[model samples]
Target: MPNLYFCIPKNDAVYFDEHEVTHMKVMRIKEGEIIDATDGNGGKYKVIVKEIGKNEAHGNVLNYEFVAPTDGRLVLFAPSGRWERLRWTIEKAVELGVDEIYVFNNEHASRHYDDKQEKLELIVREASKQCVRYHFPSIRSIEFLDIFSIAPESTYILDFKGRKIPKRISKSVGIIAGPEGGFSKKEIKLLKERFKSVCLGKKILRFETAVILSTGIFAMKLGKI
Candidate 1:
């Protein structure tokens, strides 16, 4: 098999027209040479060069394969930590392959990020390309409890207040962590009523540590990793 290059269209033989032909011919690739291509849609294609002309090159289509982009679950991450930790969490979350991320700016939240979503998105993009993944996770702007209430089901809040860590994985999960000062009593109560609060054992964890650990453990339980 030849080296691979990612392009827009996927799962078909590529006809190297003009520019591409010049590129390949200049590189001295011969007829019948195999090449690989990806469509950035979780699919890969292998093709064999059939003809190489001055201005164009045609290929014989070969087999194709795909890896599903969307994992079975939708994940919601409520931002509640410090800068260094939150940034680290975002990177790890992208590496772990969370579907969606939301940074919640609670009334009592400690850290306020000016461009948290943008920073995290850059991290996800780099991680995605490094992993050769066609799709990258989505990160939304900072929000509050009022915004979170309407989110999809299967929500989980990673709080130390609850008993026992979560063990089972479902179709979707939303994890909420508090700030350094922790959530206000009212915030805790409201979240408990709206979303299930999950404990991460006896030891109290820093906001950033908790965020990364919670998502990592959740994926492990779901067998996604």
Candidate 2:
């Protein structure tokens, strides 16, 4: 994949951040070279390096276009206890075309841990570049209750009783994955009330594994991926 660059929108031009410029310096990029850049809001541009400084980069937009997101928004809800696990799931989901990721604390989830929000953000940014995608996935932590309030076209919970997905889902959908200890009775009861409880298979799987496989399967069934 080509190295994807990012810049902030400024009228007709774009400017790179300190970290992004430093990365280009480390990569030994030179002026007058053409590169692909994204605004992280659907605009992808073909730019020519106009200038490179110690802490910034200036590029001239040669051409640009907006990229429509694939199919529809796919939101993944996962446990927020372990940063590594959360980051892994977030990265894979972003690469596989997830639009947003919501990490929330639940009844069975570990409540004692660092925020690690920076690490999660960095992971999604890097994954977007690596996958050569123009759309950026929004990543944030939320209360477990806020998740259920989202009005998606379809709602699915990762649980034991889920069978093969019956039909292709073509609208906005939410996938909820539980923590290592699984959901509490109240959580399960709530899930049953609001969404279809779905599963990957008979065999047990890790939280990280469950995320990517479920995303890929659903994306495919939706005639995407």
Candidate 3:
């Protein structure tokens, strides 16, 4: 089996930059070796390695293909938290096939997420390659609490206090996972009006874990898992 690698674009061409070039040379992938390439947005191309150099590699395009992107109907609302957990959530959520992951500042969040946007993007890239997923999940900057008002989709809140358990999704879904200490009463009330309050279960779950598990359940319900 060919060892697969992922590449992000620096430009639109057959050539890949320094980092991927190093991998190609180190792995001894010679000219004419069949390699698969993905553009990380549902695009996959089959190419033949034509030239290898110290800092770059060029491939001859053989064929191209793409998977229809998972629609943007599902949006994950991840409350800000520790870097490790945040990265883990992003990776797992991508692998699980969430359409979008939205990190947001919350009342009980312990850490700040202003920085590290680049690092998170890298994690998503690696995770996509590792899981052999064609479409890269969208990761965006942290939004504010009031931002919820702008979304007109069916928002599902993963809280124990939720009155409804989601069984099916007919339209776009906005899933909100609260911070470590959970959402405040005021915040919960604010969200309740914007989203249909739903519970994952009777038991409590950690921030990252809740996002993944609840997403999985929703996916299964929607027949997307």
Candidate 4:
């Protein structure tokens, strides 16, 4: 497969952003070379590089394909913790086909890091490119209680004490993974009241481990993996 890049299409051409231009320079991509690109929506393109300027690269579209969006949404609700661990979780989640991610704060969270939206989005974008994903995932931070606004019936909490994952699930579903220290009693009570819970296994796992494992399992049930 040709190396995949990302661009926004305008008229019959596509313009690569600064990040992509830098990537092209690093890869020694030259004018007239054919490459694959996606708009991070559903459009994929075959393009011939036309020009590489100081800040951006331009290409002429040779062919275009539009992929239909996936059938269901797989949303992940993760707790805020160490930056390195959280970053790894985000990258792995995107590669595993998570549709959206929400990083939240809770009572038992080990540590709190200021939400750097730009850096987080950058990580998501790069992960999408690396995985050659046609549709990129959206991510943001939220408070623990904010989950109430989502469809509680379709949301699940990951806990070792909870029931095993169901063979079937709703088309749109969300999975919530607690922090390193686990959810406080009050938080657990509130969650059990509103959301269903699923167990990955008998053994406990780190927050990031739970996020990735639960995502892969749900994606498999959804036939996305």
Candidate 5:
């Protein structure tokens, strides 16, 4: 497979952003080298590097292809936790083909990752490139109760007391994984009232583990994995 990078396409050319320019430098990509890049909106390009500057790289678009987005979106609702664990969850979630990721603050959330949207988006972009994904996932923070408005019927809450994940999910769905501290009774009651609850198995999982596990399960059910 060709190495993938992110780019901004001009009329007949593509420009690598500063971050990607830095990546190019680290990879020692030279002029005249052919590379693959994505616009992150389904457009993938085959480009020939023409110039490498201190802050940018310019390429001529040799070929372009548009990949249609996949069916049945998989959205993840994960609770705030330690930055390292949360970062891992985000990376794996993107690799697992999640369409959107929302970090929520709940009663039992151990830590608040406030004002980390930029970092989160960077992670999403890097993960997308790593996986050669033509379409990139969106990431943001949200209030815990705000989830109900974003596809309630298809959303599932991960909890030890919930039912086993079904063989298949027929529509776009969201999976919610609680914080490391677990859910409080009131929050659990509210969640139970709004979303279907599903369990990975009998054993309880850590916040990041549950997020990845439930995401993988949902991705498989949606035919993404």
Candidate 6:
């Protein structure tokens, strides 16, 4: 089987940048080999390697296929907590087929996110390619309360004190995972009023854990898993 790779779509072309070329070299892929690649926007391609250079490669697009978006989407609302914790959550959530992930400000968070949009975007791309997903999950950072502006079609706030989440849920679900230290009392009051509260279990979970469980359960409920 040909190895799978990812590329940024340029008009009707896909260019393998330095990072991708390095992987190609590691895989011993050479000129004349056919490889599968995704544009991360529902477009997949079969390319025949035409030329290779020290830091880049060119391919001839032989064929293309378009995959439709997933039926269910999780517009996850999570705190901008520890980078590693947030990264894990993002990678797993993308692998599980989350449609979108958004980070929000948390007053009690261990550390706030910095201006690392470039790095964060790369992480999402890699996670999508790692799982061979048909579409790239959208990731964004929003001001604390701005999250409500684009609230889910069906919003469910994941909390420890809420009722158990129902097995069957709406196809388009939005999940709100609390901060590391849990939401502030004032924040909780706002959340309760904005969304329907739902619980994952009796025990308390970490910020990242809550994201995983909440998104996973909702995705499974929609049979998107």
Query: Which candidate should be chosen as best, given TM-score against the real structure?
Result: 5
Task: Output candidate 5 Cα RMSD.
Answer: 1.8
- Model 3: residues with Cα > 4 Å off, grouped in runs: 1-3, 8-12, 22-28, 52-56, 149-152
Predicted candidate 2 versus true structure: per-residue lDDT over 113-180, tens digit per residue: 33766767777888888888788888877777878786375878887678765577757888888888
Model 4, span 82-144: residue lDDT tens: 888888988899888998888888887776544588777888888988988989898887788
Q: Write the per-residue lDDT of candidate 1 for residues 1-225, one digit (tens) a residue.
A: 134434344235566546456556656879988876555456666768778888767776686788776556657566655666666776777766677767778777677654666666665655554555555667776667544654557777777777566456676666666666667788777777877777777888876667777887877665556
**Candidate 1: segments with Cα more than 4 A from true spot:** 1-65, 110-117, 146-150
Flag the better candidate by TM-score, 4 or 5. Answer: 5
TM, every model: 0.66, 0.90, 0.84, 0.91, 0.93, 0.90
Give lDDT: candidate 6, residue 75: 78
- Give the least accurate 10-residue stretch of model 2, judged by summed lDDT: 111-120
- The alpha-carbon deviation from the true structure for residue 224 of candidate 1, after best TM-score superposition, in angstroms, is 2.1
For candidate 3, the lDDT comes to: 0.72
lDDT tens digits by residue: candidate 3, 98-217: 777778887777876668787777777778777877887777767556457535377777877776565566667778877777777888788877777777667766666677778877
Task: Please report, as a residue range, the 10-residue window in candidate 5 with the lowest summed lDDT.
Answer: 144-153
Candidate 5 off by > 4 Å: none
Tell me the spans in candidate 2 whose CA falls farther than 4 Å from its real position: 111-118, 151-153
lDDT of each: 0.65, 0.79, 0.72, 0.85, 0.86, 0.80
Clashing pairs in 5: none
List RMSD in Å for every model shown: 6.9, 2.1, 2.9, 2.0, 1.8, 2.2
TM-score, cand. 3: 0.84
RMSD of 4: 2.0
lDDT (Cα) of model 6: 0.80
lDDT of 5 by residue, 1-225 (tens): 237889999899999988888888878899999988999999989999999888888999999999999888889887888888888988999999999999998887777766888888899999999988899998988887787787547888888888998876767888888788878898888888888889988887776677777888788878776
